[model samples]
Target chain A: MILAPQALLSAQQQIQRDLHSCLDYFDLPHPLKDAVHHAVMLGGKRVRPALVYASAQLDGDVMSAAARRAAVAVELIHCYSLTHDDLPCMDNDELRRGQPTCHVAYGEATALLAGDILQSMAFEVLGSRMFDTADLPNPAIALRQMQLLATASSKMVCGQVLDLQAEGQSIDQSHLENIHRNKTGALIQAAIMLGATTVLPVAHPSFTHLRIFGQSLGLAFQVQDDILDITADTEVLGKTAGKDIQVQKSTYPALLGLDAAQVYAQQLHDQALEALQQVTGNTQPLQDVTQFLLHRQS
Target chain B: MILAPQALLSAQQQIQRDLHSCLDYFDLPHPLKDAVHHAVMLGGKRVRPALVYASAQLDGDVMSAAARRAAVAVELIHCYSLTHDDLPCMDNDELRRGQPTCHVAYGEATALLAGDILQSMAFEVLGSRMFDTADLPNPAIALRQMQLLATASSKMVCGQVLDLQAEGQSIDQSHLENIHRNKTGALIQAAIMLGATTVLPVAHPSFTHLRIFGQSLGLAFQVQDDILDITADTEVLGKTAGKDIQVQKSTYPALLGLDAAQVYAQQLHDQALEALQQVTGNTQPLQDVTQFLLHRQS
Candidate 1:
């Protein structure tokens, strides 16, 4: 059966339902809840969550309760990061995904608290009930997943710190790679790992192969993001385009030239596909995800 | 026989060592690591960590790796809350524990990220290895603890939201109670519950009684804090004194007369001890801690 790149739209809708159900379970103060909803429900591409189930090799339309928890967990972390990053003190963006940013819609303080609580909610979901299949769900899986999420979350923050410190400075390619690898790459790898964890033990050889696939794909995705920032207009991008250059951020185009960066992106894409080839199980979803990421416009 | 209030001094030292060791385990970027260390290490009274061990009813000097995790987790959350609460947009306090606030010591962005990362670190610590004694460590215990902590942490943020909204408004005692219950009482209850989880199951009778003890003590502690803010100087308080009144916040002393607030504090203290009486374990440490909380001048 040919799966023409697992339907990201389907995964997006399913994740929205999962996220809505999770939010409905809690009754927060009105403003806080509204802010959280605005921040989360305004919605992005749901690429990370889609990657989660894809890496798990689940059918595009099927749901694993365990994988749902992980998908929600990563999405929450991603949403919260965006909210806080949009704060006046951080990236200071006024819009995200074609809507007023969280801080702009809700005041900065509300947005900050909303972001902070979303993070706690992520762990709450993850540490709760696991896959129903594990008659007695293993604690180690949750522990290992929590550890991975925390580490990635930490690295992501570290990357931001590096980004903030490196602003306005011309840095080399190596430093630039280090920054993206953590800033965006860490969480991307984490999403893939969490999904893989749903089916594989921590020591499985497939994990080794999966990690390489995640690493290469993550960089390739960032490289595409860089390319789009220069190529796409704000209307198409749903955010202010050319932001990387505006902020004087060191990007692939800036360091390696647009031509070399495009070539590098293709190289990374090929590398990612090669790594996935080593993994067993229905690797089709991941393969589709990799191909989709390499060619996505926004 | 008597534990001298379970020697909060000792717990503070051990938790400090534990936190320092945790920090040393990671080689974070220089500025971020420094910010985290400053936020975690510039030491508060360690009241929450002390409560963790006190509720566990362990010998003052003895260490349980299990209880230690709970202790560290709550402390990390408390520290991060303080760091965020002290932000210019929030409380705007420059001094904490008689030193510069995190935002003041580090830049606002770095301080924000530090507080943010400290939260992830808390779950990282909690969801990792469990008690050394559990032949096969149970995931339920960690899940329960994480849920309690997350819930309490969420409530605390809500309380802050309410408090922010209540600024410049004349609120009733019950409203103030609602605010304090979420902000301070929830976490206090969580600490007691987490410590109890170390030695007791979820449905243990002692947990019910211990919760009441925690509720009353939490209120009493906040009531005492209100009294201290009104009566103490900045030097003694280590934070801005009389600032609550300056900000027109509704406090116990603000709603009730100072003399009446003191009377109410004593009544709450008595109520706390009354609840502790129903517990069957080594109640001495808890009793001592409650008494210490009642009389503590700072």
Candidate 2:
């Protein structure tokens, strides 16, 4: 369940490098650009990017350029969603992953714009010169990956809307699952799928199984997030704990209770592993990732 | 300048078919899907798509599919922006293209989800089976086209954010241009570029000239929009007129006065025609489209 030392270090380095490139090309108007720069500097696990890089390398050494481009693209989508979700109109949270939220740090309007710019920049990155360097074999496959990213992004945004709406409502299991699926699961699935798509021509056989792995892992990831929201301290979790309950936002733990949520997460982990089993070659990195999803405390 | 009888009719029919296919595949939650359908059905010129169809036809007649796809995709991005812009945290408007706004017709949350879903669906349409039909010679080129679409969509979203920020602020000419370029011109450019890419394999010595024609026209088109915002009435324009002034939004008219805005638009229009002059054969459609852009009341 733990991140192996080498895997963890490599993921972190990839995240840092990709994040740097993400902010490198944008030409935002004054303070807005600076604000976004600050947000990126504010630490995040870069777990999504890590999953991409690690999974891409699981079979053997893959091209860094291809893996990194996909990693950055997924993370950009992830980061942009975080920027919007923290907006006053949505989550209205003052803090995120430890630091003040984008809106909190630089007014709601700028934060909203920051997120918008980031989202646009992500696609630009995917479509830009860097992608060309990846020698993506097929421009069409890259475009398809971009489409997948967009779909995942929309799901996340929709999830935010639904989560906000569910705030005072007594939602059932189906509704909660919908919220998480859109919010957390979609991108996670996208991150994995994007990585697979990068090598889709070569790794064509593994696509479906990889997608199923992503979906299962994504569900497990959200359940873990819910558990952390309640069980982890603010310092360990970085953001305010129990904020989900305070805002009356729906969460797996909130609906299923801690014990049941844990069971559900375990089930997803099992399913994710099962899906992983279908793919040939080394799966240790994916296994590590799934374990981390189920067992991470924060 | 008017849509040549045959050209105009075919463009309309093509767009209608594309929209039908787009909606057929999308699965929005019941009420939200209905709301989007309503918003989309409420009319606008379908100007963006028409431009693609016109530009594509200039090269050859084999772009029916590309024109339709680009048309639907641009419309979706436009609709999503309108929905989000109407949210309480943003422009807080109540009407659009002549009907009650998406948020006004649907609850704000559902409207938001509808918009989000529509954006995702746009990318999906580009990547979906509809576009993938018959399997082209180069799927990679098709992917590149989709990537171009995503890039444009991202720019539009960023431009929306910029527009939101520019309200109640004093912006210079360049800033206003930047906003419009990203907001409107980016997608317009994409529409034209995509049409060319689609037809390139079928029609050699392609429509690179058509794309240049489009970029110039697209910029001219936005400048015209600025002029219309001040000169046109709410009844004619559909949305609230002079709300640009009301909200202190940055516009060419706002920055340079009405006379100057008109001059800018006309100059851009003339320049657009100059660009079109490079194309040797059948400039009639191109010329007509250029003049229509400047002279149109709405």
What are the Cα lDDT values of the candidates?
0.84, 0.73
Candidate 1: the clashing residue pairs are: none
Candidate 1 chain B — worst ten consecutive residues by lDDT sum? B129-138
Give each prediction's root-mean-square deviation over alpha carbons.
3.1, 3.2
At residue B235, candidate 2 shows an lDDT of: 92
Error of 2 at B180 (Å): 3.1
Off by over 4 Å in 2: A1-4, A131-137, A161-175, A200-203, B1-6, B131-133, B136-138, B157-175, B201-208, B253-260, B280-283
TM-score of 2: 0.89
Each prediction's TM-score versus the true structure? 0.94, 0.89
Report fnat, model 1: 0.66
How does model 1 do on interface RMSD, in angstroms? Answer: 1.6
Best-fitting candidate, scored by TM-score:
1
List residue ranges in candidate 1 displaced over 4 A: A1-6, A58-62, A129-138, B1-6, B58-62, B129-138
lDDT tens digits, residue span A1-298, model 1 = 1233546767888899989988886678869999999989987788899889887763243556778888999999999999999998998999799999998998988998998898988887776663344543356776667777888888889889998888899999889888889899999999999998878766889888888888888889899999989988898788889888989998999989999999999999999999988987888877777777877777
lDDT per residue for candidate 2 within A1-298, as digits (tens), equals 3454577667877689767866776656566777778667676777888788767765676645656777887887777777776666556678787788987788765675566556656666666666344354356656667677878887786676667667889999988888888888999988887776655564477778988898889888888888888889998898889988888877788788899999998998999999999976667777776776677777
